[model samples]
Target: MPADRPYDRRRLLRDAAVGAAAVSTAGLATGVPARAAAPAPAGAPITAARARRSGAVSFRWWGTAGWRIDIGDRTVLVDPYLSRYDTGLFTGRFNPDTPLTVDAARIDPLVDRAENILVTHTHWDHFNDVPHIAVRTGARVVGTLTAYHLGLAYGLPAGRLAPVKGGEVLDFGDYTVEVVSSLHSRNGSWSLAFPGVRVSPPPRPEKISDLPEGDTLAYQIRVAGGPSVFFTGASDLNERNLTGLTPDVAMVASAATTSTADYVPRLMAALDHPKIVVPVHWDNFETPLTNPPTVAASDRERLDDLIAAVRKASPRSRVLLPEYHTAYHF
Candidate 1:
């Protein structure tokens, strides 16, 4: 909390309560704001956007484990993978030669004015195509050491890349970011199922390491006007491990065997019980992924269940699981 922080617990409770109501309205009609917020601020405002959120705060899910968190003047993308996931873009085959083929055209507008891109790990889906965006926009690439170099391979200057170790923090124009520890897994496919339905994931590269992605990381961004947002790259939440942090919003992963309602319940019960939540790492592939299994409609249904569970687990928490490119203001 390096920033001279403002923690108005009452405002947070009110926003979460009100935001949930608005999101429910918007969710039902796809346009309703349970309640309207103030007008939006122009891009790159000299001073930080206020906590009042005069404009909107939204989460746009772009298949795979990606999200564009739009908070008025500044837009932030987290572990984005907008392309068809199975297109070898994730394997080393695509990166070393093909240049992570994303639906860049779709990505362009989402990141139209993004000042920072948070890379959760060096995994292909999270970090690969980002450098392409960074080089084109000169946006800062924030992640681990390997991610920093991988960015260089994609033609971005080292200066534009900011390497962050776990448990560290960085400063954005009007916000602060805290890096969370990530428990990364190898890329091999494993057995998975949903409601007794079974499928296998695609063939994955031989694991390069086994320490749960030494460089895998999560982030907590404390912005001026909004609540504190926490992002989980890909992890199995351990209350013992994350007990130290208090996050108002969490972006957790639910793919493969991890899509079960059980997997998320325990995790949510242990955390600070965020006011808002978003699910990632599900339904992000070109076709049926070839080991265990990948994101599918069952997974989506499971996601539906996860949302329901979140509501039950934290009655006050507002759940936001948006479709690709959809916008929300909270």
Candidate 2:
């Protein structure tokens, strides 16, 4: 079960009374707080200012699996990997023992507003920029103990690191997030296979490969009086763990391979068929953000197959393909 309500009864009652009084003063019988009011109905024309003022939830894709989610005044970043390291340079010669330089300047722009950083795993592409982003934005880092240790190794402030092994619900004033245990996408023949890093005393690795794939996590984020979004950084999912979560939006990964060919349908059913399906992590990460995103030839077939499967399994749901750095209002 989640933690008990963090508010006292008297405080709740007083807040309700104050809200009512404000509504009365504004001559509105709807009893909705001016700042907490809903935006125009779905499909209705709404400006960015109106949406923000109305406390509407918005999401901006930053290529790869990175996303900036804004719910009212709060902001949360998921699997932010904006530092597009030139992996090709390392190629067959890359080694875990070698030190890799991180360019924080490459990550600063996309993370200016992040209040919280949610990491799904410790894979390089998913976590390399996290420590720098946390340092730059003064955001709290949430992930498994492995990720926490990695943060420690990276010199991240202790006060900003939150280690959890899933099944934890966190309240951040404007929204509540539930961390659910999840599986990583299939890597070649082995399912959920990756080197596990359990460094004690925190070696403080300076190489990209030093960060191994820690426990994977999926997030179910519910914004206050707004939309709920479920995001998975990996292509695979644990259906049993996601049984009753029916988020309004599902940010599904479409690039990597999955455990089985029926992964898409199973994922949709597991999520209880979300109303909006957005395919993420489908673009090539090796390329810089300056270049228009292009679906890798190897991933194109699987991406198309996933989209087709989603359409077939959940015909009523809308498939939204988000562009790089573009904000999608929900």
Candidate 3:
């Protein structure tokens, strides 16, 4: 493996325990420590005035596949995992036993209000902070039946969970969320990390791997008089499922490799070549949620490739690279 590309998934999975321990210790010494339990850095929160600013709906990237979408006083969070806990995934020593955690100090300031939480999948990076957020803000958790069961297992109130198996058009007064069945991004061998689903509530999740992929789903959120935005936590998708969505903005996740054939072109064409394409899920999730987000060497390269592909496939579509905690209006 090259020194620059620290996070080779196949290599990380193949590494022996002894070698992984050594690398993990070395990584902790050299890499940025996980700050989910530490005090949030200054200037991390979106202010009240800016969050609820009059005219347009506000969207802020929270790293990974996380996003905070504020539609007036009501807020909708999509995969809002702010913990960013170090699981050794990006340190060349992936540990499936990393305990789940949440830092209210880090998440509270930014997500003061929310009406709903849209989950794409139950992966740790996407769902670890979800249960806590759902309980904290009293927001309805919407996702697969697996997500509902998992939320129940996590002690979330039963009434707070809304399970869907895709193709559900839910009206939330000012806005609507149309659920679409989707596929998770594949690894080198076209496999997922922890693939499975919880048909019923199981034991309380204690570690990272406990949260399975739990099936993948995408969401298209459209504000009554505003723009319609599409969000997917993973890179791969079923083109047929996106037929007539034609969202104004699409939050496309960057893939680890070109495993999905013509990913950009297919997605662009599927969504009628969205007007604005925002690349997401490209940042390193093991680090702190700070400004100038941390992008591993491999992720940076993939992001560049994704951006170029978008430009080539959808020349007219505007691509916006989001900065953490910064507010963006369509």
Candidate 4:
């Protein structure tokens, strides 16, 4: 069980932090807190188009909380950040002024078919490539009001962005999406980086810090007569909002530190112990999305802890650590 409600942000931050020698940099500038990239074993690439006709849903991880979910002929993307440009995040020298970039050459191939793009927050890693992808694919960008404002600031057409404040069950013929109000993962200080919301359109974001947290959210994509998948862009979640979700697959994020109360265990129970738990946002985001995904030396232990906790909490659930671009069918 988790600690009592009404947490003490400052106290937790102080207790969770190690001395300067072993400082935990979780939820640092990149909002991933303290993740490092190390290589992961390669997974077999299984593309099953024919399986789609039988109500099979295909899922592909785009690294750092991004996913490509295919339901029949339509495609839905969640926090799809494929640019993976260098930001000095994992290099021990964090740079807040890193310029925002778009790698069309890389993103073009993966995102050209998306019909709907879900934004979990306005953080740079999650939202940087959204505008470009939405414009190119003409997909509807659904997220918070701040995400909508950021989309407009990025020159995305008003009609192309849909502002949702959770509790919206949108039917898209072959599937439906349920938006849940959520929270961003806290840093070692029990605070978030670049925290703030833009109620209205703000200046165009040029550098990474220019884009604020703008709040966070989680998404549940339910395929018609098939499987339901839950995606979280940040490690922390709103337990109250997750009740009764009971997804077939849950793409849970790994915590950078132990700030949240029993992060993994509480989530597994709240979601009714999903049949499959796919851990996301665990790899090194600064590195390119290639075979053998990278994890930092320190992050290796954190990733193991997350997996172990999931297994203990839900012994029957299968925990799948995703490899970049590898297809998974449920």
User: Which candidate number maximizes TM-score?
Assistant: 3
In model 4, which range of ten residues has the least summed lDDT?
Answer: 11-20
In candidate 2, stretches whose alpha carbon ends up further than 4 angstroms from where it belongs are 1-56, 89-99, 191-193, 199-201
The lDDT leader among the candidates is: 3
Candidates 1 and 3: which is better by lDDT?
Answer: 3
Encode model 2's per-residue lDDT on 1-330: one tens digit a residue: 111322211111010011101112123211221122222234454443455456456687776678887665557899888777654421222333445556677776556567899999887778878888888889999998888888888888778999887789898766789999987776444333345856453687667567777778999988766678999887767799897788988988873443346888888999988888877776656567653464334335655666678888987677766656655665
Extract clashing residue pairs from model 2: none
1-330 in candidate 3: lDDT tens per residue? Answer: 553343456322211111111112122121221112211223334433443344336788898789987765677899998978878776667778889888788788777767799999998888988888887799999999899999999899889999998899999777889999998887666566788999999999999889999999999998777778999898788999999999998999887655678888999999998888877886766778886566655344565677788888998887776667766776
C-alpha lDDT of all candidate models, in order: 0.54, 0.67, 0.76, 0.75
Model 4 lDDT vs. the true structure?
Answer: 0.75
> What would the TM-scores of all predictions be?
0.68, 0.79, 0.85, 0.84
- Model 1, 270-309: lDDT tens digits are 6677766666564434432221223333224545655666
**Candidate 1 minimal-lDDT segment of 10 residues:** 9-18
Ranking by lDDT: 3, 4, 2, 1
Better of 3 and 4 by TM-score: 3
In terms of lDDT, model 3 sits at: 0.76
